[model samples]
Target: MKVLQINSTVNSGSTGRIAEDIGHFLLQQGHESYVAYGHGNRPSSSRLFKVGNEWDRRMHGLKSRLFDHHGLGSVKATKNFIRQVEVLQPDLIHLHNIHGYYMNIHGLFEFLGAAGIPVVWTLHDCWPFTGHCTYFDRYACDKWQQECHHCPNIHGYPQSWLIDNSRSNYRVKNQIFNAVRVMTIVTPSQWLANHVKQSFLKTYPVEVIHNGVNTDVFKPLDAPGAGGRYALNAQNYVLGVANVWDTRKGLGDFIRLRGKLDASIALLLVGLTRQQTDGLPKGITGVPRTESVEDLASLYAGAGAFVNPTYIDNFPTTNLEALACGTPVVTYNTGGSPEAVEKGVGYVVEKGDVDGLALAVRRVLVQGAAFRVNCRLKAENFYDKNDRLQDYLALYKRLCAVASHQTVYDGLQN
Candidate 1:
């Protein structure tokens, strides 16, 4: 089988790693694989197709801001991509996170509808269903259910500075997206699957496949100097990691925890930008963003507990990573975060409940040394990277079989 995976990046970020994993999995199974991505480092094994350059990205972003055309720009590049897809003639096309200002969504969907390709779209966020924003949970908006006009999150990501074209964008997206005859929807969490069922995307079958982490890299290590590097011996630390530190990821919640928690227990935050980490609060230790998974694994092993206070998330793999490192997790009950953290492995508090969050941290710590083994076991049982990749391979084979049968029937009729 020949597979072509489309995403914003090839090997970096969560979604990119998913695409790369699928590519490598296909190759190992004696199938051809290709990856088409917008930005970031491309993996060495996969046949890579670069969608657009940095200039194209900047221009598309500008156009989106001025015209409220988040996905309608970059026409020429998208047309070229259509030709490239035609050449590949993949057995299946897997799509992930197309809202990164690279492809002209209108052109891509039009091609898919015309070509009648078997498509599997893994929705990493709610952007595909919404008019403007990737996430509406933070805003508590329900307008996406009816029609996404007068979008409340227009000023958010892929921000539109001038016009409100959500009504038009919503209409156009529905028309083009529904034109594709064969498409399957995949979500990383049941919560996202439920939301997709309530939206225009409900017409298709929805599958829930939780995201996985590379357990081998994230596994517990008794490395020398792990504790001393972070000064772990002197203080009890609660660890938090994010690609960015902001209100969405509970930066403010951590700040609030500092005042509430005992002075002996310290807060350690990783993956902050230099600017974000510049200001020093009395009780929190801020670390800049890192690409080294090994470093993160060591940090996770050293910390007393991993705390995720995200207000909105879709099956965060960070929880799995922490668990893989044999660290107990205390996370806010948001989206699929609590789902990854099985009973006995971690604690979950309601969103924005700072007091509850702080208590959960202490509760996990009380569970102590015996509980760390449970965390690692949970990761091995549920969040192994190879098992999750196999799930995708199985889905592809099933969908391709159906597509083949339908093609044969259509040919007979003709």
Candidate 2:
């Protein structure tokens, strides 16, 4: 079988890695796998295709900034990509994060509507349904459930400096997205699937497939030196990590939690910008993002507890990584963050509850060795990378089978 996966990036961030893992799984199963990406170059085991040039990305960004027309620009890029798709004639097309200043959504969907190819779209965020924002929970906006007009998150990601074209964007998406005849939506968490059912895209089937982590790479490490390198004790530090630390990721909440934490315990944050690290308060130690998975695993293993206070998110992979590394997690009860924390594995506190976060960290510290076994067990049982990759492969086979049956039935009818 030939499978083509399209995403914003290759083997990079969470979504990119998911795409890469799925590609690798297909290749291992003796199937042809191809990955077409729009941003970032990363090593992958599958055939690689670059969707558009840097100039196209720049023009798309500019269009989004001036007109609030993200996903609608890059018309030529989308046309070129569609031509490539025709040549490949893939048995299946799997989509992920297609809105990162890359392909034109209208042209892509129009082709899908006519081509009669099966599509599986894994929504990493709320961007596909909403007109403006990738996430609406932070602002308590329900405009996406009806019609998006005068978007509250106009200044957020895919930010627009000039226009408010959300109403039209919503209408266009509502029309084009539903036009596809053979498509399925996948969300990493049930929280997101429920929201998809509420949106205009409710007509299509939705599946919840939680993101997974590589236990072999993320499992507990015996690096005794990991603590000394960060000036933290082996089991006396509270850790937080993100690809980028910002207000949404709860950088400020960590700063506030520092005051409530005991002086003996240390606070460490990974994935901070140089400026962010420099501006951090005295008690919190900030480290820039590390590309080495080994280094990240060691940090997770050494921590007493992992805290994720994100205000808006859909199933963060960090929580699974921490659990895989035998570190208990303490996360805000926001979106799908709490879903990773099964009972006895971690604690879930309300968003912005710094006091509750600090208390949970203290409890983890006290429980210490007790939670480690449960954390690791939870990860191995439910969040293992191989198991989740197999899930995708199973879905692909089922979808292709259904498509094949429908084609045969149509032929018989004719």
Candidate 1 deviant stretches above 4 angstroms:
223-227
Q: Where's the lowest-lDDT run of ten residues in candidate 1?
A: 226-235
Error of 2 at 335 (Å): 0.4
Candidate 1, residues 141-191: lDDT per residue as tens digits? 998898998888898887999799988888888778888888999998998
For every model shown, what is its TM-score relative to the native structure?
A: 0.96, 0.97
RMSD, one per candidate, in order: 1.7, 1.2
Q: For residues 193-298, write the lDDT of model 2, one tens digit per residue.
A: 9999999999999998889998999988776536569779997899999998889999999999999988888999999989999998887888988777788888
Residue 88 error for model 2, in Å? Answer: 0.7
Please identify model 2 stretches exceeding 4 Å from their true place.
223-225
